[model samples]
Target: MKLLLVDDEPVALRFLSGVLAGRARTETAPDGASAVAAFARALDQGEPFDAVILDIMMPGMDGIEAARRIRALERGRGREGACRLLMLSCLDDAEHQIISQYDAGADGYLTKPVDSADLLAALANLDLPENPLDGAE
Candidate 1:
């Protein structure tokens, strides 16, 4: 599994990268623009990941818009969208309001300061029928 992680904080990036070491092939983007660009690069490079971990708040487009664009790409590809999205947010009750309001194309929403075990569990649960917007294979 290749992971495209988009976060603005260097510390958060380091922590996540370290924890994800044995789980998947991890690639990162520090902001929204790079997230989209990196997504394209991964597709073009023929090394698309199984999932994406995106930060909800960031400079230049934010995670919602980026996800929308990725959905568009998935549509254009004429197949089930492959990359599951895990949204990371700092907003209170983010899973309810913040994620509910936006069609950010996420497989799941996780609040900030997430633990390592929870993160791994989220990834493991990505295969659930209700989770993968595009039905899992």
Candidate 2:
């Protein structure tokens, strides 16, 4: 799978990338605008990501707005079976936040300080293909 990981924190981004490295090919963005640009470029290249792991609290365009724009872009392109969006946030998993995430087109949500198990579980919940590296060392 091809994945896009977006986060403002270098440490968090590195950790997440390390965790997912064997499982998927990943590209990253440090903030929301870059995330959107990368997404568009992937689409243009005809090699769109299978999923986008977006951080919620980035400066400027937040994950919510980025998700909305991504969904809009997919719609504009008439893209069916578009990439899944999973939101990562340090914020509490409050009802309103969850609802807003879904409303903005997130397929799943996970709280920060994420573990590999939880991250894998979240990805499993999406309509993704089986990971080839599932049992690799």
TM-score winner: 2
Q: Stretches of candidate 2 above 4 Å error?
A: 133-137
lDDT of 2: 0.84
lDDT of candidate 1 over 38-74, digit per residue (tens): 8877777776667888888888888878887777776
The model with the greatest lDDT is: 2
Question: What is the per-residue lDDT of model 2 for residues 1-137, given as tens digits with 9 covering 90 to 100?
Answer: 99999999999899989988778999999988999999999999999889899998899998888888888888888884488899998887577366646678888888888987888878867877655534433
Name model 1 segments beyond 4 Å from true: 94-102, 128-137
Tell me the TM-score of each prediction against the true structure.
0.84, 0.90
At residue 61, what lDDT does model 1 achieve?
Answer: 83
Model 2 CA lDDT for position 39: 92
Question: In model 1, how many backbone clashes occur?
Answer: 0
Q: Indicate the residue-level lDDT of 8 in model 2.
A: 95
